[model samples]
Target: MSTFGVIARREIRLALRNRGVVITALIFAVWFPVISALGIAAGAGGDAAAVAGAIATIILPVGVFMGYLFCADAFLREKRDGTIETLLCAPVSLRRLWEGKVAGVAVPAYLTTLLSAAVTIAAVSTLSGTPVAAEPLLFLHLAAVVPVWIAAAAGLIGAAQLALGMRENQILGFVFIFGLIFLIAGLQGVVSGISPVTEAVLAAVGLALLALARFIAGKVTKERIVRTIP
Candidate 1:
């Protein structure tokens, strides 16, 4: 396997072994979708548009939150324990390392978000006594835009964790989490009627942010990270 794949697989293995984090992530992933679906079903009477909108609105935040959960300690833990130094001496470039870590966190996060979506659809159908499904655009949103956003989030958060002190990371982590929560909450009404144009625009924005995060991650140096270690 390539270095990137090896690193990514390692991180995935570590993430899965953290039973506390995994269980917490699973609860959030399942709870939000179920609650949102129940509310939408009660109000919209199993309307496909409403169900789709609820799926679109809830899944993005759930996926991003999962990324945050998995990546919260990915870089920081390594740096704190002095493992990052050894890894840094390896032949792999910093950008590839960042990509690998981001991919590692993003894969499971995206899958959990898919589970959230499925629960949403199932809940809506069960409650409404009809087979309701998401629109294709929403599926496109899930398949394409959601993963990109998760990757961007993981990359940015991992960069922050690597570059900042523990205190700064804690403060900034709270800000990032709350900021994202509020932003998604504010967008709930707007995304409910989301169109193809909106999905395209979101995909473009996610890609741009992912690119920007990659550039930022590439700029993070070993010296800077070592200095930030507590």
Candidate 2:
């Protein structure tokens, strides 16, 4: 019954009403994992669990994409539909509304990802020949942190959409593309040493840029509105 929870539920209900959104999201969450696992299992003809690890790579990009997609829709949709003004008229603070929107999408998308992972595991076990050694402990670690990463990525996109409006083409597109670059960079560093702090700092920098973009967008939008009202 908390404000965040209420707002989250409300947003979720809205998303649910859109069959396309729900179904498409479910496809992203499930398809890649299942297909990758099945392919590796069948090709290698080895342990089913081992094939699941290969599918984890698919989760990484999908997670980033989902995060951005969710956040973008959350904020941008409100603005497009004039719901933002109505929400602002309510008791919800700007920050709280933002937080609620993040949760609204992240929670459901993440749960779908989890279910997809389960399905992948089962299918791989039956269909794959690769050794499947997915440790329960490792899964726990991923589950705990992946959501945070997704939230961060989504928040950046939401902020961009809010602040940049029609001008967001370059900025939002760059950030979205940057996620892929970051992943590639990380892969390149696989053989080299990487500090935990460095990783955290990089993530912090991305979030900071997102916050700055949002602030700038707000100012620009407000100025444009004021100018038009002559």
Candidate 3:
């Protein structure tokens, strides 16, 4: 396996082992999507497009939240356990380590987001008592754009956690929660009438953010991450 794949698999295993983290993420991924799906579908009252857009909004924040949460395990837990320092002493470049961590968090988190979307789709369809599907643009947003967005968001969070002190990481956890709330509230409003234009705009933004994150991840060094640990 490639270094990135190995690290990602390792982090996925570690993250799944955390009962609290797994439980929390599972609940958010499963329940909130179901609830939101029901609410939006019922509100949209048989409008498949609106319901789909609304479902996308519900999962978007959840994806970001889950990414940050999993990243805590990948980035901060490694630092706290001293594994990061040991790895820093190894022959691997810091950039590869960072890349692996980002993928580690992003992939699983995106999977959870996919689950959220799936659950939402099923629930909304069931509630509507008919086959409901997203518009092409909205579907693209959920399947393609959201995953990239989640990766970018996770990369940024993991990099920040690696570079910050424990105290700041604790603060960052709170920031993530509040940021999630903010995004959910704001997104709920704007996603109702999602158009191809909206999808294109968001996709562009996501790709741009992902590029910036990759650049920043390459710039981060072992010295920077290790120095931040308490």
Candidate 4:
């Protein structure tokens, strides 16, 4: 395997072994979608528009939040345990290592979001006694755009964790968690307003942000990382 793959697999193994974090993230991913589906069934009888809207408003944020949850294990916990120092000494570029860690966290988070989406549709269909289907654009959003958004979010958080001190990471974690809460609250108003054009625009922006995160992560030097180590 390539160094990147090796690093990513290692992180994946570690993430799975962290049953507490994994279970908590999975529960969050599953619970929200089912609750949202219940609301959609009651309000809109699980119509396609309602289904699409719920998927749009809920899936992206949930996926990103999963990234946030996993990133603590991928970056911050490793740093705290002093394992990151060993990785830093390995024959891998900083950027590659960062990318690997992001991928490790993002893959599982994205899969969990997929599970959320599936449970959401199933719940809506069951509650409404009618088959609910997502719009094609919304399907694309879930399959393609959502993963990119998750990766972008993970990359940014992981990079920040690598570059900042523990106190700063704690603050960032609080800000990130609360920001997602506020984002979810704010999106409730737009559940029925999401359009394909909006999804496409968000996808484009996610790509840009991911690239920007890569650039920022690449700038984190060994000296800086070592200095930040407690």
Candidate 5:
């Protein structure tokens, strides 16, 4: 196996062992989609396409938030447990390590989001007695755009946690959690802007985030990470 795959597999195993992590993921994966579907369907005014679009929109942000939550456990928890130092000393380069961590978190988070999307679509289809609500564009959004954001968010969060001191990591964690909360609160307002023009905009934003993640990941070196260790 490639070094990246091996590292990612290890993190995945760790995530599975942490029952709390899996449970939290399941709750978010199921709850967010179901709730979003219900809320939009209630006011959808019989527009299945609109309900589908709303659920898709909700899933993207939720996926990004899930990535952050798991990245904390995947990356920051290692620092708390004193394992990060040992891992930093491993033969692999720091960039590879960051790739593994980001991929590890992004894969699971993205899958959970996909599960939520499926559930929401199925539930709405059943309720409305129409198989037509599963919009192709919405699914395309889930399959394409959401994963990019998940990877971007995970990469940035993991890099910061690995590079920063304990105190800064705590502050960052609070900032991220609260920042996501604020975003969720304004979700409806945000969704309105995701039209055709914003499809290109979303893609552009995703690319920018990926570029930033790569920059952050590139900055992670053994010397810097070890210096931050308490």
Candidate 6:
């Protein structure tokens, strides 16, 4: 097996051994759908599309939140347990090490989200009494999009925890990340005059910032690093 695969196995194994994490994830997997069903029943005024959109909004955020929890633990617990130093001393590139940790943590979180989403969709169909036909292509789209979003969120959180060793830094990192999310969401609501080119430019800039965060974390794991200029 490749170095990344080995590290990924170890990380996943450690995560699986944690009963609290498993139980919490299971609870989320079950409750999210039930809540969605209740929401659908309470507010289904015959608009299937609106119901679907609302369901997506609620479920996607929950997924992202779960991804954050999965990663928050993964990033910090390994180092806390003294395994990270051993892992880092191994014959593996920093990039591959980071990649493995990301994959190991992200896979389960994404899977949990997918399962929760499926359950929620089914519940919506049942409670709304609407014959919901899920287009295969739409399902495929969701399957692709959900993971990417989760991975992106996980990457942000992992990079934050890695770069910022202090608890205050982690809190600030989360504040900034969520602040950026809301900022972008707000911009989307008010960007009638913004050109597509500008939007693309902004996205590219954001991605570059993430890349820089990764780079800095790999270089200096001791001090907290935060970007002042976007």
Question: Which model scores highest in TM-score?
Answer: 1
Candidate 4 structure, TM-score to reference: 0.90
Ranking by TM-score: 1, 4, 3, 5, 6, 2
Per-residue CA lDDT of candidate 5, range 50-118, in tens? 666566667777887878877777877777788887887789988898888788888878888788778
TM-score of 1: 0.93
Better of 1 and 2 by lDDT: 1
lDDT of 5 at 179: 64
Tens-digit lDDT track of model 6 for 125-188: 8787664444332254245544555656666677666665656545865674576456445543
Question: For residue 113, what is the lDDT in candidate 1?
Answer: 80
Q: After superposition, how far is residue 100 of candidate 3 from its true place, in Å?
A: 0.8
lDDT of 6 at 24: 92
Q: Which model, 1 or 6, shows the larger TM-score?
A: 1
Which lDDT values do the candidates have, in the order given?
A: 0.80, 0.58, 0.74, 0.79, 0.74, 0.63
Candidate 2 has a TM-score of: 0.71
Best by lDDT: 1
Better of 1 and 4 by lDDT: 1
What is the C-alpha lDDT profile of model 4 across 47-144, one tens digit per residue? 67665676677778888888888887688776788987898888899999999989988888888888888888788778876555636767877877
lDDT of 1 by residue, 120-167 (tens): 878877887655563687788888988988887788788788778888
Taking every candidate in turn, the Cα RMSD to the unseen true structure, in Å, is 1.8, 4.9, 2.3, 2.3, 2.5, 5.7
Clash count, one per candidate: 0, 11, 0, 0, 0, 0
lDDT of 4 at 55: 61
Worst 10 residues of 3 by lDDT: 183-192
Ten-residue region with minimum lDDT total, candidate 6: 221-230
Q: Candidate 4, residue 86: CA error in Å?
A: 1.8
